[model samples]
Target: MPSGRRGRATWLGVLGIGLIVALLAVAWLQVRQAALLRQAVEVADDDAVLLVYQAETEYLRLRDEWSRSSDPRRVLDAPALQLRYDIWVSRVGLLHNERIGNALATDTGFAETLQRIDRFIRRADAVFAAPDGPGPTRVALQELEPELMSLGAEIHGLSLRAAHRVGEQIAARNATVQSHNLVGIGLTVSLSALTLAFALLALRQMRQLDRRRAALEDLAEHLRSARRDAEAASEAKSAFLANMSHEIRTPFHGLLGMLSLLRDTGLNQQQVGYLRTAAESADHLLAILNDILDMSQLESGRMVLSPAPVELRALLRDVEALMRPQAHAKALALHIGTDPALPERVLCDATRVKQVLFNLLSNAIKFSDHGAIVLDVQARDNEAMAELVFVVSDQGIGIDEATLGTLFRRFAQGDSSRSRRHGGTGLGLEISRNLARLMGGDITVTSKPGEGSSFSFRMPLRPVQAVPAPRTLPGDAPPPPRPLRVLIAEDHVVNRQYMAALLERLGHDAVFATNGREAVEAMRAAEGKPFDIVLMDLHMPEMDGIAATRAIRALPDAAAATVPIVALTADAFTETRDRCLVAGMNDFLTKPVSPPKLAASLRRFFGSTGGADFAPEPAAPEPAAAGGESPPLVDTAAVALALQAMPRERLAAMVHSFLDQGPQLVQRLRAAVRDAQPLELRVNAHAARGAALNLGLAALAATAETLHEGASHLPAHEIARHVQRFADLLPATRAAAIAAGLPLPAGAAV
Candidate 1:
């Protein structure tokens, strides 16, 4: 062949190979899509059939209950049966909703199977609803009996066909994948050979055109320089984004804290309402910011789900409680009901579920104006598969059909007008839907022009069986019967009062220390016994929880050295929580402690309810008569030894520095407030946190933490509140410090 024809023929061969490869890929994609569709339909069918089974089981159960009932119970069984029957009807609708026939288009076997299941349901309903007068409904049930079996058999047959189809699709995909691999290998080898051939030809041409070499060299050099410049610019852009995020977060925290405090301030009714609305708006803003952070993390493939068994009813109730306030404000009737058939608990991500439910309910409230909102949970069935469905419906501004279609899409609001009115980042629904699907479920919406709209989120959840409680710790070995005397070291009056009440309720006597140093002193003065446990607050004046715990655990006496120390803090972040555990604290409790949590902690420390054996020994005999004197519940020498474990000079220095600077810091904070400079107010507040934290000034550090978190967006008065708090802290902290006999720096008055 002539050289031109040979070259043209080679190009044609390459083109043909490319076309064949593309066609195969398209076919493979179609097969994969078809397989997914079939699987979905099968799942839907299975769920429908499962609901039917549950209905049948319930019908039989109710009938049996009715047979055993005398009067009132029989009446109850009738209503229960009716409820299950109605649910069964709804489950049939779910199957029809799948539109499997239409979706498969030409999958006749699957279509017929769905039709059979529908017919079987009608027959089963007739037998299920028959009056109790019948001697034997066997004949009536027999009609359903064959159809039920056949329906199942047909479904099974369809499933097999679907499976076979999926297998074929898989084979096709494998073949296509193999073809692609072959094409790629062929292309690589062919291209390499062609390049080598071209190189040989180019060498000959270069030999003939050596005069042009300098131009090519200069072009190559410029290209390399441009590539390097582009890379550097890209890195700079990333750094800028990171810096911006960090900067925004720091000030945003301040804004949030101030807003929280403002919410606590006294205001007129209307002003209070407005403040609440503003706070909620701010909270929503913070959530959006957090979502962006989460999205970034998720995109980087760093998101991991820590799934656990969750009590679904409890989770749902919590969501309803949170939204009830919003509904009440709107004067809208909000009703929440659950399916009688839904398992009490399920294995899923509880937090994610709550987040999804919260988003849906919030939307329902936001869009509604007059009519009641109803959230109904039901056990939906399609054939044999069971799934839980959550429906949130409202009589508010309904979404148009056009917009409803894209309701769950990312960053999509119903329309521009709604987006403006609602003021959302439009990520709530998308995140909800993603989270739903992540948990083997999905979210969908249905709305009409003027009526109400309903959003239903459904997920496939595994049925949970209650596990029997453990009898005892292994081998029937009982825990030690030592009496537990707990020392509670907390500074906040309200918190201290609440903890004291909780401890007293648990049948344990508690000794209170207002600050860290007093707690240490109390332990040191005890003559006879050892305090079994020390519940230390992370932020306290004079000496804080972490240090106090370290001090106590380092004591020379074996009982004192080994006494369990639990940390109490307001921060629930992983880093903070982990630090307490690593610092030798046995456990941690977040602030606003509930009674149950408090009791649980006590139970963990002391076995069974007879009585705690640990006690703190009372100091010196001069204060009490011999008969009234209790045995020393703590060892003073051991307490002193623990305090000496850490470098005494360093601890003393930190204490002196905090006291020396306290007055000046307070003065600067007051000046900042007088100037009405929020930025300066927050700067002082941040400094206060570091200083107070070092000195174990719990109350001041918490106030500082709050101010630092809420500084950027808080109103002026909110900033003023923190500044006032800082001033108040100075006097109380000095008094507590002096009372504990800590040396104050010269001229620093207590």
Candidate 2:
């Protein structure tokens, strides 16, 4: 039973036992009172007055016998007279009993009267016992009669007093019995009252129990209804995000394509500038859309993680590479420390792990005013397994306990004021925590206001065997003698055209397929002359790349089925890539595809005998500027490589196109600053840097890199200065291009 019910039972049982015992005591008391009253009545009936009365009767009889003897004719037989005297004397002796004696103890004559009677009996007995103990004579009888008669009167008086005393005692006993009856009545009334009270208490307790049960039932119903509503809402939100993602991405591809194609069109620097700004804004929107898609996938439980052996030092380098620029921009120190005991290779989802670390480091840089952000990696040996812990501590404006509770919540920021200064989707921490939990780990934070916050991420450490050394690029190499035939499967017309131009420049034969269905048909038609590779787009009409890859694999032609298939799409989600891989694709790539990235993908599948590692290594740092004069703005090596790849006319066209677009890009930079769209500014700067690097526009790339580095935090004035530097670099870039023998548009400054 419940404790509450058990307690109630105990109290009720005790009360009932007490009532029974009280009743038993009352019964015993009544029995004792009856016994006492009976004893008192017996005592009242045992009065000495009765014996005194008997004695008086005997005395009267003796007196009559003496009178008869005195008459002589009545011839008193002396023996009979003596017998009557003796009988009277015997009756007098009986008066000496304790009851009679006590009744007259206070009367002085009571003892004297007893003595007088006894003396008379003795004298009469002496006379009657002469010779043969004859009866009392008339003279002796007269003397004894006087004494006996006087004693009779005294005895009668003593009996009257005894009767009065007995009457008082009986009266007192009767009063006691009346008091006992009153007490019994009171006890009965009290027991009735107590029983009634006990019943009322029990009824009240039952009523309370009923009320509590009803409340609990109502609460349960409310919870059930709330759960149903939450599930329905979650489903609705998932559907909405999916629909939005699909709807936005379709046209977004076209927008991206249009922006890329616009670069080749002839236009003034200002017009080119507008186009670059639009492209950057589009990229920012795409990034935000990607974040939302990820959140949706996570919420709907569709996100998948692929774990592999990852090197700790190499992964840290990757993180530092991405974070170093942001830290440099703020002049904030970024320190990464790892315990010596940390394993060189541990099993983890490298990409997801990097994503979480990047998010944490990014937030630290955003919030900290001047203090350092420290990332410490260590391994803890738990009984079951080792746990790898990553502690990211930042001396930022610390979060209060009140705000800490909501820190990892989606769309929640530490403080409302910070939200304006440091903008974000606020899904980073939530995503990180969820990912950590999915990997059999958790994320926790410790912080105090005005101090700093330390976020610790701990995941089970499953180590793997060391991997062999990674492949390195051959230094200053040329392209291979053989140029492979590549098939391009793309649904976007502009993208297809761009790919064709790029392939043509690279000295390769290009086969085109507008959709997955045609791409599959093209391979089938190739017959024995199979294509070297299939660059498949994930999203397409008439069969998506994943399905096409599956179809090709199912083909009976082993050569065709085994052809290298690299997924090409704008979708950056790991789940999308994983699905393609599961469908039997060889590789994945995100779009607005770059030459180096494309080359790397190709090198991964095909041997790189021609130009291994096409990316330019960062040049050695020159001495600090002499007389504060800026160094040369462009790197000639990339221009030389471009010339080697294609005609100078083609290289010139690309450079001129980039120069013409510089002014517009700078204008967009200014506008983003004015609108306080830091993320937009960052995207624009990043794109500018990438494109500049492609054409070897070194100074412009440097300026864009600076702008990108500071976009999220730089003051408006500082950002404006960077924007001006970009605008000034346009004419400088055109002159540099001309100095390096690259083409420029008509009426260009050079």
Candidate 3:
């Protein structure tokens, strides 16, 4: 319960307890008063006065009887005279009763009057005792009558005194009762007022509670509305970013292609220098664009890490290779080191890790004109988990506390003046930190003005067993001795012209198709001499590359159906690549493609490579590891060998066909497990393993191999688990294949 309500309930309980106690006290007081009133009434019963009056009347009757006996005219009624005497004595005795005596005790004459009556009763009893013997009771009765008559006056006086005393007592009791009634009335009024106040307080509390409840509900609704608005705004931002990426990259590709073509136009020395500057600016712009796209992906939670076992030394070597040129240009020393205890192989996403290191080193080289930049790698144990720490310390103009606070904020730099001198998007550090955090790590910086800066990047240490590097096809081999036929599909006129010129320079026969549909038609019509390879553009008016590839793969003629279809697009999203591959495209190449990149792709498909004069593409840095239990999705080396042995289109068909059978394979595996048929499970697993191995679906192949090996002795549930793992790998393998350009080279799986 809420604290306010809980406190109110406790307060109410205390009030209720107090009210009950007050009521009990009032009841007790009322009961006590009632008992006192009853005792007063019992004490003032007027019984003493009644007894005294009866004695006086009996005295008068006795006196009369005695007078008659003394007259001697009525023949002396002895029995009647004796009865009167006895009755008088009895009445007088009643006056002597303890209750009556106590009531009359306050009167001084009461005791004397009772004594005199006792004397008369004693004398009369003697005469009445002899009633059955003689009639000598007349003289005795006459004697007792005189005393009894005299006692009447005393008895009357006692009665008067007793009545006066009772009256006084009754008056006093009335006064007491009146006072008690007043006190009871006052108490009752106070209690009523107290009860009314409590009721009012309770009512007010209820009203407050109702108001609070309404306020809380309103606040909750406002928060919910705010959350909805935020979500909508976030979705809009993501959409805008995606659209901008596609729009900008599509045009940017043509611009870069034209620049590259212009560079080789036999220019003078001054023109060549201008071209170099322009190329540098273009490269910088491209870097900024890539950073923006990466930031967007991070914000939208779409940046996925592809982790695998990587050689630690090889990865560091790649970083050094990329940064050494920049460092040398600035005349700065770059030193990279690692602890001896560090493992040879660690799991991580090599590309992102390299991206971060590259940014840090580049910044160091950019800022420092003198001194050295040091990058040290070490393993540190933190409680239960081990961590791999990379510290990049640079002898550059450092940052102040004020600038350090916002250093990792987007678009924020160390110093405004220095930031102008060193041009950047100011998103590199932020992107690096985000990437680090995404990999269960963080990047922290320590800097002091006029000194230097040290950036420490830490991530969980996960060691993996080192495996022998896969053998790759030779890159130094001579190019094709003869020219080959190549088809280009594109909608943009500039891009189509650029491609035609690039092919002509490479000494290859080039055929042009305006769109994907035209490309498919061209392939179908090429019965006499089919095209060697088709370079397909992804976006076109008539048909997209994905659809066209699917159409070509479904052709009736075997040779036409097995034509290699390579997707060339400006969109670099992983999802787009996966779609192209799943539609049976042989490979994917992001646009702004240089001559060397094109030459390399051609050399892989056909055994023709004569573009050796062009500069080679830079070797990509090894990615760091992400946490996963399965092997890599695709074995690039295997795929390369497969492409060498068979046509590219045939391998794509085999890969697609294998992926299509995922559901059926899952069903068969399930049935085998359900029926406890190990042989059937083994047969199915073996079949899957063979196909996956041929297609270079490494994760699927590994899963299938596990099932095939364990089917005989493994528990049913364990076998089922492996089958489920196999099922899950199908889509991931397809996506990985696409991201890695489908038929990738050795160690090129994404």
lDDT winner among the candidates? 3
> What are the runs in model 3 whose C-alpha is more than 4 Å off?
1-240, 251-291, 468-750
Report lDDT (CA) for all predictions.
0.62, 0.73, 0.74
Q: What does the lDDT read for residue 170 in candidate 2?
A: 70
For model 1, the superposed segments whose C-alpha errors exceed 4 Å read 1-288, 297-302, 383-385, 469-750
Q: Give lDDT for model 1.
A: 0.62
lDDT of 2 by residue, 1-750 (tens): 999989978987987797787677767766866775575456654556667667777777877777787664677687556456545654665676776677667667778877877777666657666523545566665665566556657766766766676667778878877876776676677668667866877897888898799789889999999999999998898788877888888899899998999889998665776686578557645754665775766777777789988998789866765675576467565667678788889999887787778788888888887656788999999888889999998878888878888998987877767866778877789988988888889899998887888989899998887767666687845435577789998765445655565566555678998788998888888875779888897767779788788777667565686688888865567778656655667677765455565776676555462433355533535755656656467668666655544567766777777676666677677657645578788767766665666667778877887898898777555777778789888887788788888756556554
Model 2 residue pairs with clashes: 79-135, 82-136, 129-133, 273-664, 273-665, 274-664, 478-610, 479-610, 480-610, 633-699
**TM-scores for all predictions:** 0.29, 0.29, 0.29
lDDT of 3 by residue, 1-750 (tens): 999989979988988787888788767777867876675566664777777777687678777778888765678887566556545554565565687777766678888877776776666667666423776555665666566667666766777887797788789888878877776786687678668867887898888898799789889989999999999997898678777888888878888899999998999765886686577556556755765764667877888888999998889866775676576557565667678789989999887788778888888777776666788999999986999999998878898898889999988877778779878878889988998999999999998877789999999899998676676688755345577788888765445655665676677888999888998899999988988888887766669777788788767665676677778865568888656655656667765455666777776566465533555545543543675455679877556655543456555656665676787888788667745678888766765665565466778877887898898888554776677788778778778876766543344333
On lDDT, the stronger of 1 and 2 is: 2
Candidate 2 local Cα displacement, residue 128, angstroms: 99
RMSD of each: 33.1, 52.5, 46.6
C-alpha RMSD (angstroms) for model 1: 33.1
* Cα lDDT over the full model 2: 0.73
Report the Cα lDDT for candidate 3: 0.74
